[model samples]
Target chain A: MHTAEVLASRLGLDIAVAELERLFSQPGADPPDYGLDGGHRRPIRVAYQGVRGSYCHEAATTSFPSAAAVEAFPSGFWMEDAFSTLESGSADRAIIPAENSLDGPIDRNLDLLLRHPAVRITGELVVPVNHCLLAAPGVEISDLRRIVSHPQALGHCERRLQSLDLEVEEVDDAAEAARAVAEDRIRDTAVIGSRIAAKEFGLRIMEQSIHDEGGNYNRFLQLGVGDGPLYCGENRKTTVAFSLEKGVSGLFRALWVFESRGIRVTKVDHRPNRANPVRLVNRAGGVELAQMDYVFVVDVEGSELDPRVAAAVAGLGEFSGFVRVLGSYACTCGA
Target chain B: MHTAEVLASRLGLDIAVAELERLFSQPGADPPDYGLDGGHRRPIRVAYQGVRGSYCHEAATTSFPSAAAVEAFPSGFWMEDAFSTLESGSADRAIIPAENSLDGPIDRNLDLLLRHPAVRITGELVVPVNHCLLAAPGVEISDLRRIVSHPQALGHCERRLQSLDLEVEEVDDAAEAARAVAEDRIRDTAVIGSRIAAKEFGLRIMEQSIHDEGGNYNRFLQLGVGDGPLYCGENRKTTVAFSLEKGVSGLFRALWVFESRGIRVTKVDHRPNRANPVRLVNRAGGVELAQMDYVFVVDVEGSELDPRVAAAVAGLGEFSGFVRVLGSYACTCGA
Candidate 1:
């Protein structure tokens, strides 16, 4: 065996890699038979939002290295288009950003995930974010007058950019910014993006790891079409989106179900209710007023199909205004 | 009373303005007396980040219209500096953006609020966000090559900007962008900011209300030096920041305190634990792993001083890992 394979086996990570490669491959031309040992027989086509050098592309490749093809779909700067690729059957799976360590949750993507009932998260890839300042050949860091990248990227490196005293511009994504700088050859400009992008665009690296802090990471979710696969043997994490009924005790009751079963929650986030932005509540003063509505998203340490977890989730129907399982996948904690 | 005064009185907004104006006046000539009614006697001195025409300035002026001076502090494009002005006794109170309707919680501000224990949230201001396209004299929309504003602002108007086909730039704030355009006489650039900024910067309103949604709004918080004054006697909102014990039922127990008393929670947000980013736990398989640590921030209806609310809060000290009352003030619901 190769040195890498030896290391993987020694670390007990070989099963994870093998499982990911096998599960991500395209479903065979024949209908899937769950009872069969290994389901898919053909290579899978994985879709990502940006061009080849984007973070999503890198995540897709890393997650499914054995896939036949990794396709790039222009999302018009919106992640929903990437999901549509999976929905329309053009790609077997889609990878997209779910959260960032420095930037918190990508609210837009979470909202889209909640809206698209057909797509379910199957796995997660946590990519260490290492941003570099890329510029044209022969360009030096001090030579750049302006820098451009996604707004989040600029914000992440706010202190460093302020120190450099360069005018910053915003674009749809870091890869797109790299592409723009390369095509236009803006001599006085640099782009903050992945090293892969710098190599792809033939640009010199002005600086590496320019973000405010090291160890910053972005978590991307692998989404597949349909409900979910059992995958019950391994430890798992389940994601569920829920909305509370119109009562002070609604949220408390919903959380109780999980706690009652000794399940631990990993994260919790709530967003404004898009369909009903506001609800009318009658105050003690006998006045009806408009208050914001919201939907809560939670991730917990267990599989939705597990009997204990299922019983807890079924309890949600008793008090929750709405609840749906986003996905259940093998736990990749500390990976 | 004058027509405007009569309208303000009828709307019951006069007290808020009067209290704000009274509380801010002498950026701090004396140590604050928590028990004193109408704490400060002179016209208030308020501080906000960004230049004159920025949203923070607008919020400050709108919240305390009768203040002696609304000072703009250059925070190096960071909100923490504005908080420091209050910490150093230079500004009586600092008004800053806390959250937005479209963008969810302003994560940076939330993190700042968590870190600064001396600064307490005293009140909140909800400002309707109306972004305008500002340009130099005689400049038209068609003449623009680039548009500039805060990243969040740019994202909010993404569709409109895409159709305009202008190179988008990121600046510290919209007002700063407007100032730059006015100073440089950049005929090929326009700024997306408030109409107030256009007037303040000697720029023409090339277009008004260019944001994708008209109902877009941002929530700003009023920060004061210490815990809170006894603003008892009305329907009120209490903001609290706390960290739960490392037990599965810790969060559920905390929420139980509020629900048991029939209090309603309006908002809930949790941020990663800054001091302790992660904790190592031994799983059932006897494997040690890293798990994220979080601090929960919650806003509930009813004053912190209310007997029932006080009882619930007191209960937290017994089971919570850590608990702190951010502040309590009259509820500004529908304001």
Candidate 2:
């Protein structure tokens, strides 16, 4: 038996490299069937934002390493497209970027998750970004004129690229930028992007480990298309998005939901509300045009199935727009 | 009316030109007191991490703009020293940068804020940054051998600085960088800093508006030595810091506190929980070292006095190792 397979078995997990390879290579292979008291359980297909070379792809791979093949989406907006795919019996799970260590929170994605309240937290992936500067093979630094990459990758490598004295142009994604450098449109130009992008687009690595910190990482969430997992590790985490109702004291009352129990929270983020539109309405009409309800993303300790978590979700329904749970999953504490 | 004062009154906020004038003058004055409650509330002093000519100084001026005055510290760490001052009744508040639009969150400051629970968010200041490359009179880019500034300032102007072929030296803040240029210890050394620092040190403008985004701004939070005002406007926001209790599910249950309340949070940041130090017991006993807890900084829409907020806080108490109200105040919202 392989070491990885042995480790997986010792941990009581059904993961093996060969199993994962087969799952991804298969076409809509039915996942393991687990019979519930009511009926047969349906396996899920998940979607996420980003190109093939994006770290998010790695996150999706981590979620069900040995399960049936799942579908992937191109962008976060397409995750909504995945929702339609799920409705059409194609995908059942959607993964999203909820927060990051350096970036703080992914507010826009939170809005998307809240817009789709049916999704639940099933698992999570923490992907460390190892950004690499890439160029055409055998291309030297002094020969470069312009450096291109995603706007975010640009921000991450700003210091290093500025030192290289290259003209920095923003691109949609690092992988796309790598593709640009490969097309040979501009011989002297290079791309400030990811190693994944370089390896994917057949570009050469010019420099590696350019981020200001070596610990740059992002947290990806596995969002269930329906009710969440029934059981998870004791260290599981859950997410909920909410908006408060009236009464100056209602916010105070809401705190009782979790602190009333013993469950703890790990993180939270807030963004412009997507549900209730705030409009520049004529005072007499009070009409909604754009948005009114601002959403709050909360990450708490414990799975939704836990009694405390279940009670809190059910209890907090007194709110106006408290209608979303992004995901919940067990996490390794030490990592 | 003074230009800044005119801007303040037109903005319909507590902005005074006099406080700004004082800030530009001395090293030690009580930090400005932004009216926390209203026209009747006592003013709160703010301690910021920088001298007269730093972005933090500008942020402090905008938040308070009235008597008690402004106190400036030399480094970001000294802001904590100033926080110690607030803790010891030497200063009334501290304004620290929590995040920036371009560079992402200040991880160190977030970690610091989490460790210091006594300090609360009394108010917030949004300071527009127009970074410029400053140098000595008659100095040209060709003559420059080194560029110095805070890491953040260097980062802010990273793209524009390419091709200069100068060695980048990181300093504590813009003021220090300007000081270094003025002392002439490092000839041919220019500083990428603020106009305030440039003017204070009599440095010439080497480059104007070097930031990639013209409207780049940094978000600063005013932390008061005392509790927040008795009441706030209907549009006030509440801040809280918490650590999950041991064996707690972690982040999501705490989220349910707000999710159930119908309360919406505007921002949330994770800071290292310093209170829980790693304990080392004698090797014979094998007593486990204490694990570090993660601190969450949450800004929700509403005041602490709100019942929903009360319920949220109450509920949080059960799962939280520690939870405290940062503060609440009305501010200019995007709406």
Q: DockQ winner among the candidates?
A: 1
Q: Would you list the clashing residue pairs of candidate 1?
A: B24-B44, B25-B43, B25-B44
RMSD of each: 10.2, 15.8
Per-residue alpha-carbon lDDT of model 1 for A248-333, expressed as tens digits?
A: 32566677688779886666678766555555566675644445566788787787878888988888877778889888875443
Residues B57-175 of candidate 2: C-alpha lDDT, one tens digit per residue: 66665544343534444334465665676677655566677556544455665555555667666655545567788888888888888887888777767777675767888886667
lDDT of 1 by residue, B1-335 (tens): 57965664433423433355344322223323223233323334477766678877766666544434334454435788878888997776677877676666677777887778888877766556777888999997778899998898998788889999989999866787788889899999988887768777899998776888534767777787765355655456788778777743266667778877888666667776655544556666654444455677778888787888888888877877788888786534322
Give candidate 2 misplaced runs (Cα > 4 Å): A1-46, A61-79, A271-295, A318-326, A332-335, B1-335
Per-candidate interface DockQ score: 0.18, 0.07
* Model 2 residue B46 distance off true place after TM-score fit, in angstroms: 19
lDDT string, candidate 2, A57-156, tens digits: 5566555543443445544445466455544545555566655544445655565565656655555555556678788887888888888777767776
What is the model-wide C-alpha lDDT for candidate 2?
A: 0.58
Q: Which ten residues in a row have the lowest lDDT in candidate 1 chain A?
A: A27-36
